[model samples]
Target: MHNQIDQAAGLRKLKKNKPVRVIAITSGKGGVGKTNLSVNLGIAMAQKGQRVALLDADMGLANVDILLGLYPKFNLSHVLTGEKKFG
Candidate 1:
């Protein structure tokens, strides 16, 4: 099991040598599954041994973390408020 995990990790790292593509999906109004699609797509890419980062740019009301069932320690709001950097 450990060996398999190591191999998978190595492959994931190897895949990271290639550039990661970012795709942004936006909607003019709410109720659309933009966050859902973005989260799922990011997860799918990572599962396929690719590097992915999902950023929620909805300043007024961000929902990407909510849709992913994640309670982030900090968000873009913190960065904009000078609490964090662009990690």
Candidate 2:
């Protein structure tokens, strides 16, 4: 399918020998500490000199920025809307 080709092209664009790794922490219940765990884990990894990015995918009710005390001018929505690109 077209999507598969696009995915392959995207992979080909990545630097050789360097692959992307992703981790997801989720729970069925709200207010259970997913955000806290994500923040802490990201910080720990960064402290270890590893590249880390925490995405707040909660859409309308996002709170990771607040929890991290950050004010992001751009987010995934901007990227999805073609207003920005992941560099």
Candidate 3:
């Protein structure tokens, strides 16, 4: 199918670009350990001197900052609305 071909091409491009490894944790039920695992893993990687950026992509229900107890002046919404940059 065209979709499969496009996906294969995308994967090949990603392989050639040698981007950093990406991990995605998904689930169907709420209150699972997705956020917990992401935070702990990110912290552990940082403790090991690895650069890490943990993004909670739950657009409608993001709580990474809440769980970490940090208030961010800007968030994905701000970026999407052109009030902030993705950088």
Candidate 4:
């Protein structure tokens, strides 16, 4: 009974979804430091315990992963293809 009650409360919390803030950094030229700014800002926010998702969709400058030096086994591509589940 206690476990079921706890799950019901957790579901309530999830239903009260928080507002999301999306920040995009863009530029038309290279060597303008957009990557550095985005990475640093994301790190600072994460340090403050804020959820941050940095989307580096620019193929020409897809360096967020490289800048953070993170070589993750899975990526957005895997998630999109249903190879992995979010949960």
Instruction: Give me the candidate number with maximum TM-score.
Output: 2
Q: Is candidate 2 or candidate 3 better by TM-score?
A: 2
Error of 2 at 81 (Å): 0.9
C-alpha RMSD of candidate 4: 8.7
Give the lowest summed-lDDT range of ten residues in model 3.
Answer: 2-11
Deviation of model 1 at 45, angstroms: 0.6
Q: 1-87 in candidate 2: lDDT tens per residue?
A: 654323234435553557767799888999999999999999999999988868787878889999889998987777666566554
67 in model 2: Cα distance from truth in Å? 1.3
Q: Which window of ten consecutive residues has the lowest lDDT sum in model 2?
A: 3-12
lDDT of each: 0.74, 0.77, 0.77, 0.71
lDDT of 1 by residue, 15-53 (tens): 578654557798888878888888888899899988777
TM-score head-to-head 3 vs 4, winner: 3
Predicted candidate 4 versus true structure: per-residue lDDT over 1-53, tens digit per residue: 55332323433554469756768888888779998999999999999999877
**Cα miss at 63, model 3 (Å)?**
1.1
- The parts of candidate 4 lying over 4 Å away from their true place are 1-16, 74-87
Candidate no. 4 TM-score: 0.63
